[model samples]
Target: MPKIIYVDPDGTRHVVDAPDGTSLMQAAVANGVEGVLGECGGSAMCATCHVYVDPADGGRLPELGADEDEMLDSTASPRTTASRLSCQLTASEDLDGLVVRLPEEQI
Candidate 1:
């Protein structure tokens, strides 16, 4: 399992063990982590699962896909280079200890 660290807007941290192949959004939603709504149920159509990958770990994440790139523009929060849809990020050994910061809002 990969350990994912989700940091809420107010700085609360929720650590979760995500099984291999599970989306980060799924892991967060399942573990009751605040700030990740996953409203689209792991689909890249919605930006509700937006998160900011820790810059230090950015290189470890998979490349951004077309669907996620398009939806990111619709996020309620401003997007940055580190912005990513958690639903598009799959858990794997390479992503162990991945840390992501939640935006102020996910609507």
Candidate 2:
């Protein structure tokens, strides 16, 4: 299992063990973490699951796919270098302890 630390907009932290091979969004949704609507499930069509990855783990994640890259451009919040769609980030042993900061909004 991968340990994911989700930081909410209000600075609340929710730590949960995510099953390897599932997406970060799936783990968050399963845990009922607020702010991650994940309307498109694990697809890259929605920006509802956008999250800002901790800079420390930034290099460990895979680069965004073309579809996800385009969708992220339409996010309500400003996209940073570390911005990513949680649904696009599949959990793995290598992603253990991944920390993601939730955006101010998920629309």
Candidate 3:
């Protein structure tokens, strides 16, 4: 299992075990991490699972897809180059120890 670190807006950290092939949003929601709503149930339709990937680990993520790219524009927080829909990020060996910062608001 890969490990993901979710950092809340207040800087609190929640580390959770992410099974291979599971979306980051799923892992966060299953583990009760704050600040990640995952309201769309891992679908890219909702931006509620938005998170800012740690720049240091940015290279390990998959390229942004069209649907996710468009939805990011609708995030409650300002979008950054690091912004990504956690629903689109799957856990894998390459993503072990990945860290993402949750936005202040999801709605």
Candidate 4:
């Protein structure tokens, strides 16, 4: 299991053990981590699962795919270089300490 660290807008951190192959959004929603609504159920059609990979992760995450890049443009919160659609990244042993920060809101 990969230990994902989810930091909410107000700085609350929820450490979750995510199963391999599980999407970050799916794990967060299943764990009741606040700030990740995942309204589209891991689809890139909505920005509800928007999250920012901590820059400190240092390229541990794979580059975002086209669909993820496109939907992020619709996020309710301003997107930064770190912005990513949580559904796009699969958890695995290589990403054991991945940290993602949640925005104040999501559209």
Candidate 5:
């Protein structure tokens, strides 16, 4: 299993073990990580799983697909070049120590 380090707006961190092939949103939801809402159950329909991929590790992540790109545009928060929807991030060995920061609000 890979490990995910989720950082909240308050700078609190929660490290959770993410099973391979599952989406990051699923890992966060299963672990009850406070900042990730995962309201659409990993579907690209909702932007509730919005996250900011740490710049240091951004290049390691897969590129965002069209659906994820579109959904991110719907977020009320300002989007950055590192913006990503957790539902689109699949857990893998390459992402073993991936870290993502949650937006202050997800609605």
Candidate 6:
């Protein structure tokens, strides 16, 4: 299992175990990490799981697919180069210590 750190807007952090092959949204939802609504259930159809990957780890993730790219524009927070939908992030040993920062709001 890989460990992912979800940092909320208030600067609080929730570290959770992310089983390999599961999406980041699934890991967060399963662990009850606050702020990651995942309303689309890891479908990449909603921006509710919007987060900013730590710049250091951004290059390690796969490029966003079309669905996630489109939905990111609809997030409550400002879109950024680091912005990504958790639904599109799969947990793997390569992402063992990934850190993602949650936006102030999601809708």
What C-alpha RMSD separates each model from the true structure? Answer: 0.8, 0.9, 0.8, 1.0, 0.9, 0.8
On residues 2-103, what C-alpha lDDT tens digit does candidate 5 reach at each position?
999999998999999999999999999999986788887888998988999988898788888989999989986779998999989999999998989999
- lDDT of each candidate versus the true structure: 0.92, 0.90, 0.93, 0.90, 0.89, 0.91
TM-score winner, 3 or 5: 3
Q: Would you estimate the TM-scores of all the predictions?
A: 0.96, 0.95, 0.96, 0.95, 0.95, 0.96
What would the per-residue lDDT of candidate 3 be over residues 1-107, giving only the tens digit for each residue?
89999999888999999999999999999999968898889779889999999787888999999999999999999899999999999999899988899999999
Give the clashing residue pairs of candidate 4, or none. Answer: none
Residue pairs with clashing backbones, model 5: none
Best by lDDT: 3
Q: Between the candidate structures 1 and 2, which one is better when assessed by TM-score?
A: 1
Query: Candidate 2 residues 1-107, lDDT tens each?
Result: 88999999889999989998889999999999987889988778889999999777878999778998999998878999889999999899899888899999887
Clash number for every model?
Answer: 0, 0, 0, 0, 0, 0
Candidate 4 on 1-107: residue-level lDDT in tens? 89999998888999999999999999999999968988878879999999998787848888878898899999999999999989888999999988899998885
Ten-residue region with minimum lDDT total, candidate 1? 54-63
Worst 10 residues of 5 by lDDT: 34-43
> Which regions of candidate 5 fall more than 4 Å away from where they truly are?
none
